[model samples]
Target: MSKHFLRPPGAVAEADFLGRCIRCGKCALACPYRAIRVAGLLDGLEIMGTPVILARKSPCYLCLKCVPVCPSGALESRVKKREQVRMGTARLNRKECLNWQGTFCRSCYDHCPLFNEAITMDGELRPVVNEKKCVGCGICEHVCPADPAAIIVTPRGAG
Candidate 1:
């Protein structure tokens, strides 16, 4: 399993998700942010046409629109809060982060939808990720100004 790949909010566990998903593309169509995309032929037959979020290209905004449209139970329909979504966790690369290097930069912190909950400023004003509070929406990664984003969201269950 790729550590960088993410499913939409309310997605079931990997095994169950594969079994339950119908590849209807409804989830992709319903996404307001167009964050959800169908797995293409290169993704292999087992996951082809299934919904995936490529966070770097476009991160899930926690709009919750894709969940309700899933005809299959792959994504639960009852999750109502952004806090309830657990796509993955954000990992910070301090070496690449400007704030950690004594520069003033808060792009990751400023763009985080979870704000103070998912990302907080340390005494040095560097962004610190609170894994338990992070929903792995990848907004921080998308908004980062670095050549390689200083912060990245690792998908849940990834090794």
Candidate 2:
């Protein structure tokens, strides 16, 4: 336990970003993947109530277990990819970002399958997602450390 293994992944949503968090811990208990947690109040944050953090031990396979049962609208699903409704914009939480703090962790980069396009490692070594290249799979969001998640997915809006 020297290091924090899990973290909040990108591809989650703001409205769905713990917006409906009820502090019930039901999401924590329901997570079969064990990606979610209740770590009380963390630093650099003002969690309204019980703070549920997503520990990225294992990456999300897109099973979407915690989405349906959310008592609050905390985990609303948004459409992204028109092909199969599997893609959207992935947002990130710079406040909790270890990379943003000059750390050397690129878990999301390693986990993301999209290479040479979706996730680009900047000169600073931080993973930067290409919105156009991103498919909005929600895999990153599900594995994020932030309770509401730094990065989240949003529905693709028609222009």
Candidate 3:
């Protein structure tokens, strides 16, 4: 066996797996919390249409959003945390969310003292990110009204 194994059983093959992804955007679509973002055709060859590049922006929490929609099996279903970690840190579960249904909830957005730090608003009145401003704080995760918390934080990982 190779002593330097690339991924643990639950680890994500971010580069290869993402490269193989068909750009279906299903992972981004299925995410009730909208945590995973499927890129467009021109973002970059490395990340175009694949799951959000954890490095260019934020990191992924353990929400497993991209894992479920990978029809091509490009994205692995399981990965040990020790095996890989991506760049971006704020992640949302969506399964336990109050915002997915369009309810009036802003616990996560409200408690974020650094309004422009980790989260921001779009013209549509939803939270958009100033990626450069984010500090990867877990305050949004702590204040989320969702049971599992629609949003959470992930540790910095090797993108």
TM-score winner: 1
RMSD of 2: 9.1
Q: Please provide, for model 3 over 1-159, each residue's C-alpha lDDT reduced to its tens digit, 9 standing for 90 to 100.
A: 111112111224455654566777777676555545666556555556555533212223345555656677665554334223233356655556566556767676676545655576545456544445544444566566666567655533532
In candidate 2, stretches whose alpha carbon ends up further than 4 angstroms from where it belongs are 1-86
Identify the leading candidate in terms of lDDT.
1
Question: TM-score: which is higher, 1 or 2?
Answer: 1
User: Tens digits of per-residue lDDT for model 2 on 103-155?
Assistant: 66676677665654667788888768788776655566655555556666553
Segments of candidate 1 deviating more than 4 angstroms: 1-3
lDDT of each: 0.89, 0.53, 0.50
Of the two candidates 1 and 2, the one with more favorable lDDT, higher being better, is: 1
Better of 2 and 3 by TM-score: 2
Which pairs clash (backbone N, Cα, C closer than 3 Å) in model 1?
none
Ranking by TM-score: 1, 2, 3
Clash count, predicted structure 1: 0
